[model samples]
Target: MKIDIAELIIVEGKDDVSALKRAVNADIIITNGLGLTKERLKEIETIAKDRGVIVFTDPDYPGSKIRNILKGRIPNCKHAYLNKSEAINPKTGKYGVEYAKPEAIVRALKNAKATVQDGSENYTLTDLVCWRLAGADSQKRREALCNHLRIGQANAKGLLNKLNAYQIPRAEIECFLAEYERGER
Candidate 1:
C-alpha cells in the first residue's frame, strides 16, 4: 500500500530508505552514514527549504548525533523518533529503522515533533529529579516517560535538553505522569 507523504525524510542509509518505503510513499535522502559531506549538506538544505525535511535517524548514538547536526544546519526541521526497543530486532539483535514494524514507523512519522528554538527555559534539573527522570536509579522511569511523551530515551542531561528544546509544559508532564501512574496501579 502506498501512503502519501509531503515532506522529504532524511535517513542514515539505503536500508532506512527501504524500511521507510515499506511504511509510506515519500521522498527520502540518505546521509550515507555519519560522514555527511558539505555538498550533501548543501543539497539537504536546498531540499529542506523547498519541500521541508523530517530527520528520522536510528535510535542509537550516531543517529542522534546526525540528527543534531542536521538540526543545527536546518532549524525547524521536523523530528520523528522511534524507541530503541521498537527499532531493535529481537532475532537479529540489531537496532535500526529497518527493524521497526511498519505501524511503529507510521506512528512515529505521524507524530513527528518540531523543535522550539526560542530561548526559553521552563523546567530545571530539580524538576526532572522530582519527576523521577534523573539520577542513577531513574533509568526505567526516564524510559517510561520518554516513551509516553514520544521523546525517545535519554540520560538526565539529554532528557533535560529535550524538554527544553520541545518546550514541554510542566502541567502536561504532570498530567501524563498521573495518567501513567493510574495505568500502572
Candidate 2:
C-alpha cells in the first residue's frame, strides 16, 4: 500500500523526488544543495508554517549536513531516516536516497518521527552496553538494532538520543532485544 503524507516532504534533489513519488503520495520540495537562497529559505519556512515539513535526506554526511541546517531553522520539522545500508548503491558505491529501493523508502517514511524538545531519556549508555549495542564487537549488533528500530545507523550516543527523541519506550527496546536473542529477527 502507498503511504500518504500530508506534510510537504523535503529532499536533496530531483532523483530523490522521483524515488519518493514511487514510494508515497505527497508533495515534495528539493533543497538542491547547501546553497539555499535566502528567498528559498523564506519560502520553505512559510510553507512549513502552513503545512508541516518532513526532512527526508540521504543517509550520508552531506545529507546529514543539509538535514542539520533545516533542523536548526525548523525545529519542529519531522524527520524520516533511511538506514545507510538501505541507501547505499552497491554498484556505484554511492549513498543517497535516490539509490534506495522504493519499498525501503516507503518503510523509512512510514517510520518518520517527530522531534520532542522536552523528551525524557528512555535509555542510557549503560543500557546500550548491556544490550550489546556499544563497545568492541558491537558494530554489527548496533547496525542490526538500528535497522530493526528503523532509526538509521548512529554511534551509541546518537542512538540513545533517537531512542528518546522518537519517544521509543524502554519496554519496546527490551522486547526487541528479547526477540533478537531468540533469533526471531
Best by lDDT: 1
The C-alpha TM-scores of every prediction are 0.60, 0.59
The models' CA-based lDDT, in order, is 0.83, 0.79
**Candidate 1, residue 46: lDDT:** 74
Question: Could you give candidate 1's per-residue lDDT for residues 1-185 as a string of tens digits?
Answer: 54556677899999999999998867688999898999999988876775578999999999999999999999979999999998998998888998988888888988894322233356789999898878878897788888977767899999997786455678878888887778861
Relative to the true structure, candidate 1 reaches a TM of 0.60
Total clashing pairs in model 1: 0
Error of 1 at 151 (Å): 36
Error of 2 at 117 (Å): 26
* lDDT tens digits by residue: candidate 2, 1-185: 55666667889999999988887767688889676677877767876875578999888887899888888889988889998899998998989999889888877766775322222245788989999988888787778888987778998888876775454667878888888889898
